[model samples]
Target: MDASELDIVDRPAASARGWRVPLLAFARNPAGSIYGTVVADSVLAVESERQTKLSDLIYAELITVIVYWFAHVYADFLGSPPSGSRRASLHRLAVTLGHEWSLVTASFFPLAAVLLAAAAGASIQTAALAGMWTGVAALVLWGQLAGRRAGRGAVVSFAYGMTAGLFGLALILLRVLLH
Candidate 1:
């Protein structure tokens, strides 16, 4: 089904519970979730190494995701054929942005992890690590969901999950190499 169909399935519930829609959208946009998580992890790794404060780190991560989301939306909107009417063009822009909203939503859990860890009195570094791991876990979960959605068996699904987790690991490896 196309994005419009997916939007029809999600838009009403999304309007009712804005915060929850992204989690639901995950099934439809696993790639967006993975992309967001990888980006979040990269930001966390780099900022944590800088010994940044938790508040600053969180703000930076959020702003980074938003900027990327806007960029993705703009690129997608540009790639679409130009609509005839101005209203139609605006609608297309809205649809493109809404479709890419998963990028911002995917960062929610990892940011929450960082906030929760800090609330529990963890150091900024440790809290950032928690957030990074949460992103990794999200990636793995998205992979498993995708596999199952495709009717794969449990073992193969798990392998897919691990493979997705590798993206996070690669960022971690880069962190280690840089530091």
Candidate 2:
């Protein structure tokens, strides 16, 4: 079972014993979840000039994003050596890295959407747009979810969501301007 689903009493023992550490790391650091989508957004904004093969675009987007996500996990795990024996340390690493699995999963949705659209004979450009917009939608949804947790009402939550989601646009702008 996933760490998050375990009863609360089990969590401490599980971590102490160096069990799968997904939820613990997530509770500690949520930033890893955005790695894939953020990298994809930056890459697509700067290099999405329509010359690449549709398959290349779809594959490259997902691969680059996932690779970068792994790098983040690696960096995070290494930067701080968690307390415990070698086994426990390794478990801690796994726990920390596993939280970032969400980053890969998040990127997968848009990548698949793009690939499916292109396979269905959509224009490469249109398929790409569909994929990018889908990612933006995901970001906005994350924002709304965060807002609700913070006790914001629906409209205010939407506003916050849009604001957070627009940060993706800024990333795009940075890529376009700087690269």
Candidate 3:
């Protein structure tokens, strides 16, 4: 099972471990659970409200995954092959997939979490700011990975920017329409 699935199954166990230990553990490994918590919460909220069919919810999550994949590719491997490199092409493919995986891990999870938090009555300021920061961090990583390729970096950055913007827009629309 995926990390999110694991979290759902273990949340009771974690709670049984006691709130204090879990809180400390959460504080210690903030990044790891933060995203999973968000996605799980969002999934639960949607499932609870019956606003979306299960198939559609899964599809939406898949789109979020795709966005991350593009963002990663735009960030990491957009330039010419490295110098004196016999494995340049292979490295390119590998980085491309790595970026895709990063999207699954980094970007979408956080976005989903923010959305879930908002649904759970988190303060608007908290959800919006957290989401923005998380999305920006992902974009920054993408740009940094893009390195010296001016055009490539710009493209990748733009894609991620758009991804983040869409995330915000979707959340807002969902909030208004769902309630």
Candidate 4:
């Protein structure tokens, strides 16, 4: 669903409860987060296997996310009905980019986890693992939020969380199998 489809009442209530409303709203439409987490995790897995430097791994993951974000924005803008004029087209492009900004922001937590772990003197491989796990945790949290937002019960929400987490696990498994 697009941003317009979000439940307007939910945002205000979540904000009143001291929840991070933007993050929760993003969770309510988790395609970007899921895409970002998968991409970041896959990068971490591959870089770790190569024993890449922490800096290089971080750069690679960041660049990858930005590139993918731009690609998504471009595709979305192109797919949308064309505006009448050049200025209007540019404005539409900007709006599409803004709408898709979550794709880049969603990688923040996982990347931060890598940075923090590396700063704490963890090996590059260990830090990458931390990042991967952070991505998995984020996916699970997003899934739970989505399920609850959809009015699902606790058990169903938990199941949703598990289903989302399995994506991360599958990536990890692929890394293992490759190496």
Among these predicted structures, which one has the highest TM-score? 4
Residue 59 lDDT in candidate 3 = 55
TM per candidate: 0.80, 0.69, 0.32, 0.83
Best by lDDT: 1
Residue-level lDDT tens digits of model 1 in 55-172: 7898889999999999988988888898999999999899777777778888887899999999999998888888888988988987776677678999998988899999988887
lDDT of 4 by residue, 108-150 (tens): 8789999999999999888888988998998897677768777
Query: After aligning candidate 1 to the native by TM-score, how far in Å is the CA of 116 from where it should be?
Result: 1.5
In candidate 4 the C-alpha lDDT for residue 75 amounts to 84
lDDT on C-alpha atoms for all candidate structures = 0.83, 0.66, 0.48, 0.82
Candidate 4, superposed: residue stretches over 4 Å from native: 1-12, 20-22, 25-29, 149-153
Segments of candidate 3 deviating more than 4 angstroms: 1-51, 80-86, 107-179
Deviation in Å, model 4, residue 3 alpha carbon: 15
Q: Mind sharing the TM-score for model 4?
A: 0.83
Per-candidate RMSD, Å: 5.1, 7.5, 13.8, 4.0
What order do you get sorting by lDDT, best first? 1, 4, 2, 3
Q: Runs in model 2 with CA error above 4 Å?
A: 1-31, 149-156, 171-179
How do the residues 45-153 of candidate 3 rate in per-residue lDDT, one tens digit apiece? 3433443343454455556556645664665565655645758766776856653453355445445655766788765445544554454454433333333223356
Supply every candidate's count of residue pairs whose N, Cα or C atoms clash at under 3 angstroms: 0, 0, 1, 0
In model 4, the clashing pairs are none
For residues 1-179, could you state the per-residue lDDT of candidate 2 as single tens digits? 76666777676776774633554343222234344556666556555564368767766787887788778778888888567689888888888667667676667656776778888998766676566666677667656655665778999989866876786767655645764
